[model samples]
Every structure is written in structure tokens, then in C-alpha cells.
Target: MTTEQDSRASDAVQLAETTTQPSSVVARTSTWSVWALFCLSVGALALTALRGTQWIVSDILIVDGLTAVMWVVVTFFSGIVHSYSRRYMAGDRDIERFYARVFGFTLVVMTMTAANHVALLAAAWLAMGLLMAGLIGHVRDWEQAQAAATLARRYFLASSALLAGSLSLLAWATGTTSISGILAQADEISTSVALVAVSAIVLAALIQSALFPFHNWLLSSMTAPTPASALMHAGFVNAGGILLTRFAPVVTLEVAVMSAVVLIGAVSALLGQAMGLVQPNVKRKLGSSTIAQMGFMIMQCGLGFFAAAIAHLILHGFYKAYLFLSAGASVEQTVPKDAKSTDTGVSSVAIGAVTAVGAGVVFATLTGKSLLAFDSGTILVLVVVLTTLTATRDILRRAVLPATLRVAAVPIVVLSAITGYALLYNAISTALSGVPMTDAPTELTAAHFLALALFVVAYLATEFGWHRSSTRLYVFLLNRSQPDSSTVLTTKAEYNDV
Candidate 1:
């Protein structure tokens, strides 16, 4: 056998041995804790749903529809991650530390979600970032991991600081430290203070979500363990949407501010999709996709559909976690020799597009919204249509079934996806019913339409190979999407400890 083949075989054997070992005591206990928390969260959700009530404690912690839903989603994802990591990191020397940190991070994030006081919320947010940084640098012997951790920590710190300042300003302006109280008095806040506070919030959300200029941290964090990456993508990044949703009242105060957010999200989404297309690494590709998904989530918030944003984040979290955990299995195949047969014909592509459009119309009609009204919901419906079109076309291209079966699959898949999304959206909307400005559909401005136009143009350009014709554009995106220099290895010897 060739040297490369021998090396690959040896690595496979080592992986098998490592993954098959019995879980450590700490791993088992952590797994149990996560599952227990998940169960309790479900019960809490049921109570809230049945009672249709909101609760608060001394203005320090709040329990409402938003809190319950977040608790259920966060704990559910954390439980899955812990279970997966039991086998994935079975024999690592620092297994205990990993589990402990993961559990602590989960707790802190849950606390932040329910925190009613500004200080408690800010503290929890800060702690969440620190723990995630520790997870990224789980391997102390790896220099690259350390660098990645430091880079991520810096971004997280900046986000935390901005969040603190924004909250403080809002509190001072409104003379209230309680989140609900501050939001209730948002109308009394001075215009300058309101704009500044909300602008800082927008920046904080963008940074945490890894949108465009702030995306380097996530790209650089590829050194994190697969489980850590999964958790970060699944729960950590989604905090941006939660933050925006919590502060939706302040966000909708200024038309220009909301427009700015829409513009930022649109740019980030297009750029992220473009960059993900060029990524050669599997994990980094997933990271780029997370950036794009986060962008869409933030865009939903900017468009005034906080419930839709929450639903998108929850769905994206599950999808991403599954992808990360199964990423290893994705590399088992070699390039096929007869790839031409998989190339989709023009007729099939048209059918998929038509199906997606029809689904969008039905979705809009069912929601009792006009397609041309340019409401917040239309953007979401548009996003679904585009996503469905892409998925259906890809299925048509790759499926090895007979022509009849392949064509017939389009409507089934499209309908199922749209139906599922509608259910999730409605559930979230009900959960967020008491929250202010959550489902408030704003009139779209010229800027919003322009951003949509840019999104469509970029999507078409990327999809049709038009962007590939420009070397400079490709090179620019490639460079922008890269991780920090210090986080990349310069020699094989640097990877010896890995």
C-alpha cells in the first residue's frame, strides 16, 4: 500500500479505539445532568403553555413564553451534544474538564435567557463567552488551538462590553434596571440615547452572530472539538436573535436603525453564502453556513418578525448539530467517475423552481398576508421559497431514482418543509405573544427593497457561475473568509501534538 493509504488506515484504527472506550465517570454524570435539565425544561414549557402565564422574581429573573421555549431548545440541544461527546471524546485526558465546562456554559446561557436584571444578563453573557473560549482551546498542547481561543475570546469580550454599555445606557435613560420596565418606558427615552443604545445593540448582535466583518472569530475557531463547535453553532450564536427579540421595542423605534440592520444582514447573508461555496474544509464550510444562517435570523429580527427569527434559529440549531456530528462520515466517499449523469436537466430545475414558488404563494395566502404588500412576513416567505427551490433542485440533481419518482418528490418535500415551518412559526408566535413588537409587521422602505434586490442579484450571480468569472471577486471573498494567521499551522511539526 502507498504511504498515504497506510497513514489513513493507522489513523482510522486509532479513532476506532478512542471512540469505543467506556465513558469516564464525569462524562456519564454530565450526560445525566443534561438530560435531566432537558426533561425539566420540557415540563416547564408545558406548564407555561397550559397556564398561559408569565412569572418574575424580585425583578431579577423572568419566566415567560420566551424563557420557557429557550430553556427547552437549549437543554434539548445540550443533552444531545453531551450524549454525542460521550463517545466522541471518550478517552481524552481532559474529558472531565470538557464536560464540566460544557455544563457550566449551558447553565450560564439558560440563565442569560431568563435574566430580568441588566447586570445578571450581562454577567451571564460574559461568562458564556469565556466558557466557549475555554472549549475552543480544550487541547492545551496545541498552539493553534490557543490562538483560536484567544481570538474568539476577544470577539466575545467586545460583544459583552457592547451589550453591557447598551443595557446601562438604556437603564439610565429609563431609570429602570429591569428589562421589561426599561422596554415599557422606551418611549420616554431621548432620541439620541435611544439611537445610540440600539446602535450598540445592533453591533453586539452582529458580532455575536459572526456577521461579515465579525465572522473571522468563528472561522478561526475550527480548532475547537466537534462537539464544542456543534454547541456553539447550535445555541451560542442564536443568542443574537434572542437579544434582538428581547430588545425589539427599542429596535423598532428608529426607522433608519431597522433599515441599517436589514442592510447589514442582507450583505452578510450573501457574502457568507458566497464564501461557503469556496471553503475546502468541511468544518469551516459549516462555520460559513452558520454565519449565513445567523444573518438570516438577524434579518428576520430587523424585518420585525421576531417569532420567525426564533423559529429559524431553533431549526438551524438542530440541522447544524446533526451536520457537525455526522461530518466525519461525509468524507468516506471518493469522487465519482460518472458524475455527468447526476447533472440536473433544465426541465427538472424549472419544475423545482415552480414548485417552490407555488409553495410560497400558498404560505403567504395561509398566513393572510399579501405577497406584494412588502411586509416583514414576505421576507420570511421569500427566504423559504428560495431555500425550498435550492433543496428541491439539488434533490432532483442527485437522486438516482426513475424520472417519474424524481419529479414527484419535489412537491412532497416542498409541502412538508413549508408545513413544518408554518407550524414552528405559529408556535413561536404564540410563545412570544406577550413580548412587545415581536410580530409587528412594518411597512417596507425603499432601502428594504434595495437590499432584497441585492440579495436576489447576488444569489443569481453565485448560482450561475457569473461570480466565478471574476478572479478578483473570488480572491477577495477567499481572503475575507480565512481565519487568523496565528491560528493556522505553518509546519507539520506544529500538528504533531494534535
Candidate 2:
């Protein structure tokens, strides 16, 4: 009887262990499959770059500068996120499904980037939305994930339809289905056709980029796994900027469209930054930051700085990806500590302003332009200069450095960074000159000035209010930025029950 009981117990243990073997095998297979796909994508991108050949596959797919660069970004991020997910999601039962969805989304985005034909672009756009829906809802058992996925799917589908309409209009106007051909012949297209097409494109981009009111989907998407969040924020959100840059000629033709883009983008940027500051949750804060960055990128496109927008897109993509991957460690590292604060008085701001002005003057001189020109390029230079000065001022004020060295170091570092950025921007602009973008609108209207003034006023007010410790504004922003507690509790309960 004892021997019989022992054999029965062993058999039960084996049955329990073997039950999970199939899932383990499936997960391993999916991981290797994604690895292989990533390797092939990188090899192809490298080969295309080395050959400097625009490969046209049956007049539908074209591998050129834009496609090659974006392909490299997609593949690199996809590989990194996939590898990270393996460890981040180690114990999940749906690991295989998650990997499959990620790979599918990556492939769709790659195809979209390489598409040269209108039909192919539309198909890839639709496929991306569908695949992303699956990825967002990877945890199908959770109500929050399902709801977020549904919301995302709705917005994506709407944006996809608008993009399709824009492409159709462009093709109809240009009398060709080829993207490159349409862009090359943009000057020949009638202003009416260009206006309609460009408006559609801009509106579509606004939705896709998550400009305010339409940004809830992105915030809700935090219910997804870290890898998905990283991929979505870093890879998918930039699609709007890419679209605008690719069609710069058409979009920049109408001053109204450009003004609208700038105004909308400015509002989104301000609101996003404000919300980010108020969010208590780390991931939600990051999401808000992504929204702000995307707005800034789209605003660059509106300014006829397509090359700069592309640079920003790539840099922000990599930066956000790294942040998401390392967020867990960052939260722990940022734990509050007691440290003595120093009063730098108003000197830091004054110094920063001087440094910014000096850098801007130097940049303008280097580019053979006057500060009064105030063109798109000049604006970009000023932005870079101001950013550099801000960094320098923060360091000098916060760090315990010798006064003389601090004063000397700020100028050196600020000058060097500004020079480097200006040179890089010039090189990229020259390289992309083949892309037909008009010079910035030399004439500014009342509306344009109003938009700029609103941005400045909003920023100043926020800063002043924050510094003054205005309880009303702080409470209002804090309440508005976070989701309702009851909803969060419900989602948590559903997740745990699942």
C-alpha cells in the first residue's frame, strides 16, 4: 500500500509540471523568432545605407534616406524592447502572445516607413492600428487594458481614415500613386488641391500625435506592459511628425494651416507639461512628457523646419526608450533625501539670460544672419541657445562649485553645446534640402503673434503661480491630471481577480 501511494503521488507531480511545458516552449520559440526578425531588419537597413541605392520593389516599396534611418530606429528599439520584455514579463503566462504582438507591430511600422505607393501606405497604416490594439490588450483578462485598447483603436482608426483620405487627395491631384512623385510635383499641383490635402494631413497628424483632448488614449495606455508603453511612446507617437516632414511642401503652402498647426501644438505642449508636473504616477508623468515632446516636434514641422523635426524625433525616441527601460531603477534612485538648499538669488536667471542672448548672437553670426531676421532657422538657434543656458544655469546654481570656475565653465559649456547643435542642424538641413520645404513665412499675422504671446503668457503664469505656491492652481491641476480613484480601484480589483 505504501509503494502504491508513493507511485500515485509521483505521477500527480509529473502531471502538474508537464501542464506548463507547452507554454514555456512557445515563449522560447517566440523570443527567438523576434530576435531573428530584428537581426534581418538591421542587416537590411545597413545594406541599404552602404549601397546608397533607393530600392524600388515593384514601384510600391522604396528604401531611401528617410526609410533607411527610420528602419534602423524601429529595428533597434524593437530589439531592445523585446529583450527587456523577456525579463520584465518572465512569469506571465501570455509571454508568447506579447512577443508575437510586438513583432507584428514592428513589421507593420517597417512596411509603413518603406511604402512608396498610396495604397501600400494605407494598408500599412491600418495594419499598424490593428496590431497595436492587440498589443495594448495583451492582458486580455484585465478590464483596464481592454478599455485602453478600445480607446486607442478608435482614435487610431479615425486617424488612419484621415490619412487615407489625404493620400487619396494627393494622388488624385498629382495624377500619380507614387509618394515621391507627388512630392516632387507638389509645386505643379493647384493651391486648392494642396490646401485640402494638407489640411487633412495636419488634422490626421494632430490626432495621431495625441494633441490635447485626443491625448487620453496615451495616458490610459499605461495599463499596458512597460515594453509596449516604451514602443508606443518612442516609435508610434512620432508617426505624425514623420508624415508632416515627408509632405513638407504641401503642408507649408498655406500660412493658415501652418498657423493652425503651431497654435494647436503650442497649446498641447503647454497643457502636457502642466499635466506632467502634477501627475504623481511616474508612468503617467512620462506619458505627459511624451505628449509635450510630440507637440514640440509637430510645431517644428509647422515652422518649416522638417530637418530639425526629424532630428528631434530620433533623439527623443531614443531618450524616451532609455527612460522607460530604466524607469524602475530611476524611481528608487530618486527617493527623497534631506539636503541643504542655497539661495542663488536672481543672479542665476540674469546670467542665464545673458548667456542665451550671447549664444544666439554667436549662432546668428555663424549662419550669416541677423537676430532681427527671426526666421525659422533663427528661432531654432535661439531655442538651442536658451536650452543650453538653462542647463548651465541649473548646474551652477545647484552644484557647489568655486565661483570663478563656475562663471568660466558656464560660458565654455554653453558655447560648445550651442555650436555643436547649430552645426549639426545646418548639416541635416543641407542633406534634406532635396525634400521640398518652403522658407518660413516671412509675414506674421495678428493670429500668429497672438499664438506666440499666448504661449509665453501661459508659461510665465504657470511658473509664477508655481513659485508663489498658489494652493488653488496646484489643487486644480492635481485633481485634473490624475484619473478618478474609484475607477483605478475598480481596475485594480479586476486585474487582481483575473
Q: After superposition, which runs of candidate 2 have C-alpha atoms over 4 Å from their true positions? A: 1-53, 332-343, 358-372, 385-427, 430-434, 438-443, 483-487, 490-498
TM per candidate comes to 0.93, 0.84
Model 1 weakest 10-residue run by lDDT? 335-344
Please give the distance, in angstroms, between residue 333's alpha carbon in candidate 2 and its true position after superposition. 10
Candidate 1: regions farther than 4 A off: 1-23, 333-338, 341-346
Tens digits of per-residue lDDT for model 2, 1-498: 699999999999886655544445555665676677667766765675566556678769877666766777787888888777766776677877887788878888889888989999988988887777778778877776777788888989998899899999989888999998888888888888888888988887888888876787787777678888899889988888878877777887788888778777766776777787778789888988888888878877776777767777777888899988888875754657886543255766666777778888777665454556666555555555544554566566676776656667777778876676557556555545445562343344554566566665654665365723877877766655664232253655666686
Error of 1 at 237 (Å): 0.5
Local error of candidate 2 at residue 396 (angstroms) = 5.0
Measured by lDDT, the strongest candidate is: 1
CA lDDT scores, all candidates in order: 0.87, 0.74
- Per-candidate RMSD, Å: 4.4, 4.7
lDDT, candidate 1, 164-263, per-residue tens: 9999999999889999999899889999999999999999989988997899999999899999999999999999999999999998898898888888
